[model samples]
Target chain A: MNISEERAQAWRADLRSSMKAKERTEIPRVHMPELDAEYRSHSRLEEVNLGLSAEQAMLEAKRCLDCANPTCMEGCPVGIDIPRFVKNIERGEFLEAAKALKETSALPAVCGRVCPQEKQCEERCMHLKMKKESVAIGHLERFAADYERESGSISVPTVAPANNIKIAAVGSGPAGLAFAGDMAKLGYEVVVFEALHEIGGVLKYGIPEFRLPNDIVDVEIQNLQSMGVHFVTNCVVGKTISIKDLEDDGFKGIFVASGAGLPRFMNIKGENLVGVMSSNEYLTRVNLMDAANPESDTPVFKGKKVAIIGGGNTAMDSVRTARRLGAERALIVYRRSEVEMPARLEEVKHAKEEGIEFWTLHNPIEYIGNEQGRVTHMLLQVMELGEPDASGRRSPIEIPGKTELIEIDEVVVSVGVSPNPLIPQSVEGLEVTKWGTVVVNNDTMQSAVPIIFAGGDIVRGGATVILAMGDGRRAAKAMDEWINKKS
Target chain B: MNKIVSKEYFSANVIKFEVEAPLIAKARKAGHFVMVKVGLKGERIPLTIADADLQKGTITLVVQKMGVSSSKLCALEAGDFITDMVGPLGKATHIENFGTVVCACGGVGTAPMMPIVAALKKAGNRVITVIAARTKDLIILEEQMRINSDEVIVMTDDGSYGNKGLVTNGVESVINREKVDLCVTIGPAIMMKFVSQLTKKYEVPTLASLNTIMVDGTGMCGACRVSVGGKTKFVCVDGPEFDAHLVDFDEMLMRLGGYRDIEREENELYKEALSSK
Candidate 1:
């Protein structure tokens, strides 16, 4: 499927004919290639979105309408030059489009897969506001980045002359990686310290391979590494070496993007039963721990009846993973209605197609376990949606005397998670909210400790990958400003 | 990657694996733990250094088949390779000329105590070690304890071995007859709690080793946090060994049981699968 330079140029001219505002408005929304749902459901690992072909990418780029104001950039977290990149792709300059994306986004490939673009970039599209289809910006982003990576020519961003400055980023998640990428581009001797054995904090451990494959993460990480960003895995900033030690060791600035890795569980009756576990533990074991293998060190239980709690993306991942692990009855038991599910429409649809039963308007009150202490059944209390709550989501009110028992062997509780408290708790004099999140200057991402800055889940509690990356980009700028002024 | 030099099943669940980790074997001291990733996809599980042979360049870990992590660890046989091993983590026990030391070891705690006892003996201190478990078969590291200690006392609840009572009896009798400079307890929270109270009665200095929940044996994750002297302290970084008097055993005990249900469920399934095999 290689497009020659001459044919690509001819196609670009053909695309240019339809690139006019009036003609572009008539173009339909480009469809993304998807893996067969039936085949995907039976497999444990593999990306669902097969990614876009070069022709599809060109068509999607041509539908952008090349806005004069480019409101899509305003919607983007990292403020990627959406029109310039799309127009470049439309003009048959695929590599230039990737370079344009790299100017702003540290993880274009990852953002393409995980970012909620529909609510952001696409929502801000002119056609979308006119009650028409918006350009498939995410698909194009993935296509250009994938094209660049597969083409065996990754253009490294121009790094500044080494100012002989040293900066440290704690945790190698989206935010930390983003900061590290920008800091290295600024020619500061940057080092990213990660506590886990593998790099790419949440990207590697949290999201399953089906969403964002590890190889894609590796490519992004490798780019940073090639740009002189050093990474030290299995090194915790606080415990292994104190924050004070880092300052003493000549680190001009430190960025704490340790992320929200803590798993929260529901405090319900019999929640402590053997088969009841948090989605964090379940996913970490199954996704990261190689627990599917009976011979592996952490073998996750493959139950006949698996009920996943919560309606978030994590819950979808857990239920889908449970199905892959051979659950005969994989169910999603959420308190809210289907409309209020926090999971993406694509994921929800994928789960439905895979035979995942949805028990909406229901919340588990207790997990019934056998004498041996393994969860055997779940007693759920029926619920109905109430008025909008503080978070702008409808509250669920439990109906009294309405209970249902479902025979089950496993329960994956994916309610939510708190920010990792290691950085705030370990460093003395750092201000942390009652919720254990680090308090930082919103503009600078700098904490009370002048030398230390914080972002990502550590500051925002928990957020989407792109939001965290946005914080990283802003923090990097502020850090550079502060460090430069001091020097 | 590390190769398992030798592996032996102590009991149905307890396993002792010796891995070929030269750097860790040479650098690790008592109270230090290593985070072991069984395979590329394995989750990091913290395992305290039961013993390390610098000359042989091997570190021994005596892991019990308790949860999914440990069960998977126990399933490994000799010649199996571990994906990652990070550490000699946490603070090493502060050893000194504490004239006479009382080592109270329960269950798997006996394994960690052996090295500390050996280090104390090498430092020319008189060491008396009390090893206890539910039954005779459950007791471990008795031979190692005897080799390392000046004197040894064994206690079991079922009266299957030595004194038919708690290890507290041995400690009380030993402390009464001798000027015990420091009393160190390593075991279950209940045993350590009782030991801490017993030592407080005699006004003796006490140190208790904690095996808290830890994700990264490094200080990055606060999952292994325990209240020490009323301040939150991470066991992986601050101290797996702490003052028994100021340490919050109640909090530690409660947090330790936090995942018991899920652990038990996985254990049952694993046992079922193992038996079928």
Candidate 2:
């Protein structure tokens, strides 16, 4: 056995020996420190969730029962070895925990920050069954990842011997990065094509800095680069270089993760008004193009009263961003109640703390515009929850004759997004669903075209970063197996 | 990074660049444009692919120094590298034998019209080109337009060129003399609005290539959205070209001015930085 294998075995044996379940359970969960709500919202946009200290991380790690049957693993989309990583952190081997995370996830820091743990891993925690708050797995995961990064000696995953195969991934988003990492680890030449000037796709442009800092995403990208993944930015796969062109350039496998960036509007009156735009546009401008700056080339309209429409994480991001941009009143005009909101619980809480008003059970019917064609007011329809709909969430039905007109300078529509149509339309044999998402085999993530595979927003419409990464890892394994079998 | 192969000055503020972009040069059609970024902080401005030399692996872009990004692009000389250039975006202009086609353009709009004129002329249409600018010195691509079209009429608002009239006047003159089956207008929104109005009187079908505010040249950002036929359409994907009559030119003109103040501020900063250097 290799020296590293021997070390891993010894480490596992030590962790198995220290199984003081009762004593570990006695320790309480650690709460993540955050910037002062009043100060953070009014001042510069800084990271709110302050990372756990070393002692705090280890203490929180002890709360994990490390059950014989680790159900948290099943809850995770990537199926990260939850017990192993948590136990490593418990033993104060933070670097080892991060390495364990890297075995499955290409972006531990990112997923730790943005992942909806309440619905995922933490939801399945054994501590939850014990009538106590579940162990802060997300916080611990972040601590380990951040610890490893700050230690100055980052770990690169072990790569296999070169197979002399070439792979191409469209969009440098989480899915594409994960696929590139895995393919590179298997010793295949991987190249990621990003449509925008900057890499990191939605992570860089969609998510705001206060929640998921750009540097954290950049670090994860740097890790992928170390794994032999080449990034070609400012190159749109369908427009800059088509699928046929990639095939001709000797790329044997193609993975499209071009993302669902086309934002959907309410189709209401005055939607095309001057101050009205999509959450994607609003975030892309502020986050990616620095449009919040007054002297920026493409400055976003700084409205006095900004309203974001929707009940998702994007809506929360847009609303919070508005507050930072000095919006006197930053409000979320969601159609459904708070319980039905798709945004993470932590994000909603943080938004509330940042003074974002939630106007739940109210939907905008029309945006009234002034003579200058700028949005001046919004006509809202009060709603009430009715019978559970197809998705099992109670459907919001409009309350008849309960309309109210509210004044607003700007409105960001964050209802949803559609899959980008470039790749699906460009590739001749590629099957596309009615929703414009590429139809792929569920098991393999492969498209109708034999050499092409797709995942992330392109395949799943709009989904979480972790789910996209899961699709990437699964596609990598399937592509590797298929390529070997063909050869 | 695409290298600028050649640079030619048409006027004090307008310049044409031939950049090395082999794939875009090969795939680009008449109406398609490339998103050009001059520097790290430069805005991704969409410039029409004025011409392409497939043999030389290059694409031409005519830029008017209207904002900071355009000025930065125009300042670059031959052999300088463009930070990022993604291309051949938007639906290409539909060229067909419409018997007699009237191609009307103003200022830098003449650049995009050159390729369409050539394509229409080659497709067996008697192309009558009307190139307009404020003055004779501001007129661009007259030689190229003459080479492509059967007849080239230069219109100067200040009457310093072939004719003293607006682009609509030139287009109206052609419509009165000949049966203009199709009119292709590529210019300022105001100019296209007037041209479309003139063509509507003659009942000639007209197509206008719109230039809207865009972040990503791809259909990702709806910043380039324009109302066409009472429906919202992304100019980056659905078209840079649309039916002239159905387009809401006034709203589009308003949307285009969304970044005007910001651009002026940036231009001032750029000038200050230049003076400091």
TM-score for each candidate, following the candidate numbering: 0.80, 0.97
Query: For residues A52-112, could you state the per-residue lDDT of candidate 2 as single tens digits?
Result: 9998987888777766678887899888888788878878888889999998899999999
- Candidate 2: tens digits of C-alpha lDDT, residues B92-125: 8888788999999999999988899999988999
Maximum-lDDT candidate:
2
Model 1 lDDT tens row, A1-487: 2222322455445655654677777878888788887788767778888998888888777787665577888899898988778978987799999998998899999998988898889889999777788888988999999999999999998889988898999999999999998998888999998877789987877788888888999999999999999998766676556788788889989999998755666667766566676777677666555567555455467888999999988899899989888898999999999999988887898899889999999999998877666789999999988999998989999999999999998888888878876677679889999888999999999999999999998999878899999999999999999987987
Q: Which candidate is the best by DockQ?
A: 2
Overall lDDT per candidate, in order of appearance: 0.84, 0.89
Compute DockQ for each candidate against the true complex: 0.20, 0.62
- DockQ of candidate 1 relative to the true structure: 0.20
- What CAPRI class is candidate 1? incorrect
lDDT of 1 by residue, B1-277 (tens): 7889999878887889999987677667888888887656566777789899878889999988767667677878899888777777777889888899999998888888878998898888999999988999889888888887999999999899988888888899898898999999998888999999999999999999888776555544355666678666667766889999988787677667656765676668767887999
| TM accuracy, model 1 | 0.80
